[model samples]
Target: MDGRLIYLMGPSGSGKDSLIQAAREPLQALGCEVVRRVITRSAESVGEDAEGVSPAEFELRREEGGFSLSWRANGLAYGIPVEIDQWLRKGRHVLVNGSRGHLPVALERYPELVPVLLTVKDEVLRERLLRRGRESPEEIEARIRRNGLFVGDGSIGDRLIHRLDNSDDLAVTVNNLLSLLKLSVKPDQI
Candidate 1:
């Protein structure tokens, strides 16, 4: 059996983090590993910021063969650890928070990769962004502008891909994803 790789990519305020957090436990209970990604930015307030490492450190790690896949997005670097390969080797699917730009490369090399594009109404996204209070209104606007980028827009990666909506309750969004991915779920009954 071939394993699968699930990627959740979206706009900044589309609730990707919230959806990931809500689904983490239930997904794990189903014998799945939601692969945590490493980033080059300070974790600060993004609850699931993974772990932070400097760009230099990330480069060194990359040279040492520490990452299965690493790429930059919005001026920040992110990577999936090589250990995840072990899970895939055994036909165990792994879910990850990933850059949408990686979709094309992933599709080419790892046929198992499944990209899940997330979207929300702009107003809803703006409200969530404001509530987070992590960015100034200007920054929020910039992010939203950046978020809508896609294939025809000369964006970094292919925009034609599987997608999921996150406009409903956070938990519902997660379950909807699980359903779409055909991933197993443990009975937390959420």
Candidate 2:
């Protein structure tokens, strides 16, 4: 059987990175491979375990068809290497940190993918974004507003979109994700 793709997406401060980090070992135990993205940013940047490349290099790779999925978001370019297709064909479940804006294209390519949306309460999101110190208060407010708009607008589509709340403990979110994965993917393999 072919493996399923777990496309995880969320607002900026929704703890997607943290959840992925925490769930790595458990997911591996269940034969799942969490993909590392290729991003147009410095490796020194404090974020997910993505491969940082220059804009020129990123464009070169994209043009060469090195990526199975790619998109630009938050002024940065992100790519999922084409190797994920091989992994899926080999029956290894794969998880990717995906973009909500790019979900339509992703679904078009992999219609059986499990789309997960990580969410946080407004106050919690504000506090988390403030702690990151990457954005001004005004910018944070705008992001929060945008997040609210997206969630309320039904732009992500309600079909098969599993929502996970990351307002409290990280463990809870990780557990929730694992449970969802177990159910969404092949339970016999797990």
Candidate 3:
């Protein structure tokens, strides 16, 4: 990342969603745009983006140039709305929680993406999955394995990275992100 993308990444159950929501104000006040993705999964499930669409609808939108980029993860399809590129082209910092496996390709679009690798202890992740109460114990374990915690191929993540251990403390993690982005700790925004 060249230093402008503000890419948020981590394994499943790593508090990525919460951290992204928490960073909204600081990001916007700093002139950063948050990308709303289109997901194939049901909005009711965990890890589904709030702005979700049916698989068929997502395909239609994609065919009509609604997405800047799209990828599949664990059988689910995800699309980054085309608006994100427009905002980034305007030189606005864009904060996005993208597909972990697609980080390198995403970075190629913008030379200035600041990649942040959010991490947590394995046990903490397991506990969080349990607390969410959507997955059985076996499913949680499988998710942990699927997430492949902290195991990068050393190609993408080895580059410029701001690693945050988000184990049990979200406030600190968000604060650190704000500091890293040179954004105000508190922001007055909608």
lDDT of 1 by residue, 74-100 (tens): 688888899888887776778888877
- Give the alpha carbon lDDT tens digit for every residue of 98-159 in model 3: 76678878777765667778888878989999988877899889978866655654345457
Where is the poorest 10-residue window by lDDT in model 1? 181-190
Using lDDT as the measure, the top candidate is: 2
Q: On TM-score, who's better, 2 or 3?
A: 2
Off by over 4 Å in 3: 1-3, 47-49, 146-158, 183-190
Task: Give per-model CA RMSD.
Answer: 4.5, 1.6, 4.2
TM-score of each: 0.84, 0.95, 0.84
- Model 2: per-residue Cα lDDT over 1-190, one tens digit each: 3988899998999999999999999999988999999999986684889999999999999999999999999899999999999999999989999999899999989888988999999999999999989999999999899778656533455566888999999998999999998888766767
Q: Per-model C-alpha lDDT, please?
A: 0.75, 0.90, 0.75
For candidate 3, give the lDDT. Answer: 0.75
Candidates ranked by lDDT, best first?
2, 3, 1
